[model samples]
Target: MDGVLVDSETYWHRFEDEWVFAAAIEGGDPAHEEVTGMPYYEIYDYLDREYGTTVTKDEFVAAYQDRAESLYGEDVRLTEGIPALFDSLRAEGRPLAIVSSAPQSWIAIVRERFDLGPLDLVLSAEDIDEPGKPEPHIYERAAAELGAEPADCVVIEDSLNGIEAAVRAGAYTVAFRTTHNAELDLSRAEVVADGPEGLRRVFLGSE
Candidate 1:
C-alpha cells in the first residue's frame, strides 16, 4: 500500500527523518533500511532498542497517527498506471486483492480515495495474529481468501519484507523499483520491475 499501490513512502521517510531520527532517536543516522517495512509501533520499538529514543512509546505513536491523517488523506497519490492495471486484470477475470502491511484504516483511505472497488480481497497485517512482513502468514492468508494456491499467485511488492513474505508464501513475486527501495537487494523476487510502466508490462505479459 505504501510504496506499491500508493506513493506514501516519500511522506513516511520524511516523517521518519524529521521526527523519528531528529527528535526521537539520538544517532548518526536512523537505519531506515532496517525498519522500512516494519509496522509503525515496531519501528519505534526498534529505534528504542537499538539507539534509544527521546520520546515515550505513546508520544511516538501519537505523532505518527497525526501525521498519517494528512499523509494518506492529502499527501499520497496512487501509483501511476495502477488503475489501468487493475482494470486490465479485472477484465481478465483475475481475482485481485490488496495484501499489505498497512493497517485497515490506512488501506481504507486509499480504497475510498481512489474508488478502488470490486477488490476480491483486502488483507492487512493487523488482521492476522502472526508477525507482519518477512513472515509468510499474511500472504498465505490472502491467497487462501482468494481461493488460490500460493504458488499460483503473482504478488507485486515494493519492499524487502513484502517481497520476502510473498516469496516465502510460495507466490511468484515481482519486486517493484521505487525511490524508497532503489538500492535494496531484491534478488529473492522472481522478477524486478523498474517502475509502473515496467510493472504494467510484467502483468500484461510484455516484460
Candidate 2:
C-alpha cells in the first residue's frame, strides 16, 4: 500500500536518509537505488553489513520503527487515481490485496493515513516463515490467503524485488515508476505503467 497505492516512497527515503541511516558514518546509508522494493529486514541487514555497525539488529529495527512512525505519520499521500482504480477493480469482482515488506503495523498506519479502500487480503513479510519478496513467499502467501493460487491474482508492484516475487508466483505484475527503482528492468512483468493511471487499462484488459 505504499509506493504502489500511495506516494510514500519518497518520504520513506527521507526517513532512511534522516534517521535510520543518519547516525551511521559517511557513506553508510543506503543509496536510493539500492533499496527500492527491498524488504524491511533486508534494509536492516544491508545497513548492518555495510555500516560497520556496533548496534544490534534489534536496536536498528527499533530505531527505524520510532523514526518511521514519526515520518510517515505526517507525509504519506494516496496514489493518484487509487480510489478510481480500486473502485473499478471492485466492480469487476477482482480480489485485491497488499503484500508488503513493511511490518503489519506500518501497513496499518498507511491504510489509516490514506483511508485505503477495502482489500481482500494483506500480508507482511514477517508473517511467513519463508523468505521475503524476490523469493515468492510474500505474494504467494497473500494469494493463498485469498484462496486463490498465485496465477489467479495480479500484482501491482513498484520495486524490482516485488516484481521478481510476483513473477515467480506466476502472477501478472504491473510496475510503478519511482525515483529509486526506475531503471530496474520489469520486462518480465505482465505490464509496466508509467504510473497508476496506466494501470487502469491493465485491470480492464483494454491495452
Candidate 3:
C-alpha cells in the first residue's frame, strides 16, 4: 500500500534515512530495500539479526508508530487515478483487495482518509501470524482470504520484497515503478508498470 495505493514510500524512506539507518541501526548501513516491505515489528527483528539494533524493539516500534501517524494521516497522497481505476475494475466484476505489510491501523488510516473502501478484502500483515513480505505466506493468505488460489491472483507491488513475495506465491506480479523504486531491480515481476497510467493500461487496457 505504501507505493501502490498511496505515495507513502517517500515519507517512509525519509524516516529510514534520517533516523532508522542513522541512529537505530548499528554497524553497516542496511539498504532501504532490506526492510521496506516488511512489517515494522519484523523490520526491527530483521535489523537486529542482520546489523544489530541500537534501540529496543519497543522504542523502534514507537518511533515508527509516531512517524506513521503523520505520514499516513497527512503526508501521503493517493495514487493518481486510483479511484477511477477501482471503479473500472469493480464494474468488470473483479474482486478487489489491498495486501500490505503495513499494520491494520496504518491501512485503516489510509483507507478512511482516502475513502477507499467497499473492497473485497483489506489484508494486513498484522492480520495473519505468518511472516511478512519476501515470504510468500502473506500473499498466500491473502489469496486464500479472497477464496482464490495464489496462482489465480494478480498482485501489484512497488517494492522488491513485495514482488518477490507475490512471485513466490505464484501470482502474476506487476512491479509498479515509483520515485522511490526507480533504481531498485524489479525483474522478478511478470510485468513492470511505469506509473499510475501504466497501472491503468495493465488492468483497464487504457491509459
Candidate 4:
C-alpha cells in the first residue's frame, strides 16, 4: 500500500537515506530498491544477511513503527483518483483488496484516513508465514483469500520487488510508476502505468 494506494515511498526513501543506509547497515551502502517492498522485519534480516546490521531487530522495527505513525497519519496522500477507481471497479463486481508488505496497523492508518473500503481482503506480509515480496507467497495468499486464481488477479505495484512477487504469482501485474521508481527497471510487469489515470485505463478497459 505504500506506493500504490498511498504516496508514502518518497517519505520512506528519505528515512532510508537519512538513517537506514547511512547508519543502520554496516560498511555497505544499500540501494533503496533492495529493501523497499519487503516487510520492515524482513528488510532488517536481508540487510543483516548482506551487510550486517548495526542495530538490534527490535530497535530497527521500533524505528520503522515510530516513523510510520506520522508518515501514514499525516504525510501520505491517497493516489489521485483512487476512490473513483475503486468505485468503478466495484461497480463492475471486482473484488478489491490491499496486499502489501506493510503490517495491518500501517495499512489500517491509510484505510481509515482515506475511507478506503469495504474491501474483500487486506493481507499484510506479517499475516503470512512465508517470506515477503520479491517472493510470490504474499500475492498468492491474497488471490486465494479472494477466492480467485493468481492468473485471474490484476496486481498493481510500484516497486521492483512487488512487481516480481506479483509476476511470480502468475498475475497480470501492472507496474505503477511513481516519482521515485520512474527510472528503475519495471519491465517484468505486464504493463507500466504512469499514474492513477494510466491505472484507470488499464483496469477499466479504456484508452
The local lDDT score (0 to 100) that residue 198 gets in candidate 3 is: 95
Which window of 10 residues has the lowest lDDT sum in candidate 1? 28-37
User: Cα deviation in Å at residue 36, candidate 1?
Assistant: 1.4
Pairs of residues clashing in candidate 2 = none
lDDT tens digits, residues 127-166, model 3?
8988888999998998988999999999999998898899
TM-score against truth, every candidate: 0.93, 0.86, 0.98, 0.98
Q: Highest lDDT among the candidates is held by which one?
A: 4
The TM-score obtained by model 3 is 0.98
Overall lDDT per candidate, in order of appearance: 0.87, 0.75, 0.92, 0.93
Error of 1 at 206 (Å): 3.7
- Shift of residue 175 alpha carbon in model 4, Å: 0.3
Considering lDDT, which of the candidate structures 2 and 3 is the better prediction for this target? 3
Per candidate, the number of residue pairs that clash is: 0, 0, 0, 0
Stretches of candidate 3 off by over 4 Å are none
Q: Which order, best to worst by TM-score?
A: 3, 4, 1, 2
Off by over 4 Å in 4: none
RMSD in Å for model 1: 1.5
